[model samples]
Target: MDTHTAATRYIGPTGMDPIFNRIANWLPKLGIDVAGGRLLAVRGRKSGEWRTTLVNVLTTDDGNRYLVAPRGHTQWVRNLRVAGAGEIRLGRKVEAFTATEVADADKIPVLRAYLDRWGWEVGRFFEGVTQDATDAELADIAPGFPVFRLA
Candidate 1:
């Protein structure tokens, strides 16, 4: 349905500040959600074991929820691609569902909403882009940020 071709250009993840990353993951594991943060667990493609990580969940005006990758094409993105489903957990409360990659051309709105919500925490990964960025700007950065619609 998208007129734009899928974006193939990938930007690898920047090194996260280890202490910050750990605390972020720890809080959610302890059942405290920080500004839309949740623990996402999925089966690893190679290990076939449950892998968990911190993710920010965004629910837009139209009620559609999504998980946007601030860091480009990371391990979870790769695993989800193969697994096709995962769980979004808030502590012991786990919601299992299928995941579909949002086509690059169609990621504009989702990216915008994600930045609007998590920009302060994840703005570094966007390379100067922001929620207020134009459609073209968002489009240009879309491919680097993989998005998933959780159903």
Candidate 2:
């Protein structure tokens, strides 16, 4: 298979593939944070399935934590929304928090931060939307895309 397909296979279902999970589990020790700030565990919106996604952790100037899904329309994003809350595991500490979608204007800085962390591939994904689209508009395009803050 081509590289993209191979990568997709590895990241299958939010990097749940066995090998991917192993690597994901080890990444932090190596000093690379995969999901941005923390690892989140959420239930699937429609299937009632449980999933773990490593998302970028966003912090405001005032210190509140946020998680933004550039592809907000994805299933996991919806799941977090419907479920209203999820668990964030940072190293050995795990905490439960509510998830909220941030406004578009608010999302811009978060998206910028995400781009800074993940770079072009992520930035390009959000760039595809119109310049005028609200953060929510761009966010809505990808149902799984979301900006999650702590409860």
Candidate 3:
């Protein structure tokens, strides 16, 4: 299944996505870091204006940084697809990078590592899969979770 089809079939935004996004967006503006979270700004594919959201930035053991869409194909994910690049800001510090979507097949380790660090906050979105889940298990849900590598 393609990413869009797979995403629509699984999870979308939750009731709390907006509530938490608002709070998360506010924190970084005040110089508060919520577990490595930052404000991601990408230009809207249609509107051409920058859209912002609070996102969890995951850094793996190999020093690569990633952004995972635990909420499936969200607006930010769709926007990033068109923009191809964006900025992540924490307080006044902003880091800009090009974004490359990680294929569903290659998302295993990235998803696992993301779960390991942010599972306490986002585990429920994975439908009971944990960081300890086997490769096969991660693969089953891979299509539903869109991942990106920041360059």
The top-ranked prediction according to TM-score is 3
Model 3, poorest ten-residue lDDT window?
Answer: 1-10
Error of 3 at 63 (Å): 1.3
In model 3, which runs have C-alpha deviations exceeding 4 angstroms?
1-5, 9-17
Q: What tens-digit string does per-residue lDDT give for candidate 2 at 1-151?
A: 3334322221223534567656675654344655454577787777777777666666767787777665435556668879988887766677788877775446565655555666544555554554445656544443334577777
lDDT of each residue in 1-151, candidate 1, tens digit only: 1223224434454366666777788888888978878999999999999998899888888888899988777889999999999999887888998999999789998998888888998897787889999999898878778899989
Between prediction 1 and prediction 3, the one with superior lDDT is 3
Q: What is the C-alpha RMSD of each candidate to the true structure, in Å?
A: 3.5, 7.7, 2.0
What is the C-alpha local distance difference test score of candidate 1?
0.85
Question: What's the best-to-worst order under TM-score?
Answer: 3, 1, 2
Candidate 1: the clashing residue pairs are none
TM-score of 3: 0.91
- Residue 141's lDDT within candidate 3 is 86
Per-prediction TM-score, please?
0.89, 0.61, 0.91
Clashes of each: 0, 16, 0
The local distance difference test score of each candidate is 0.85, 0.60, 0.88
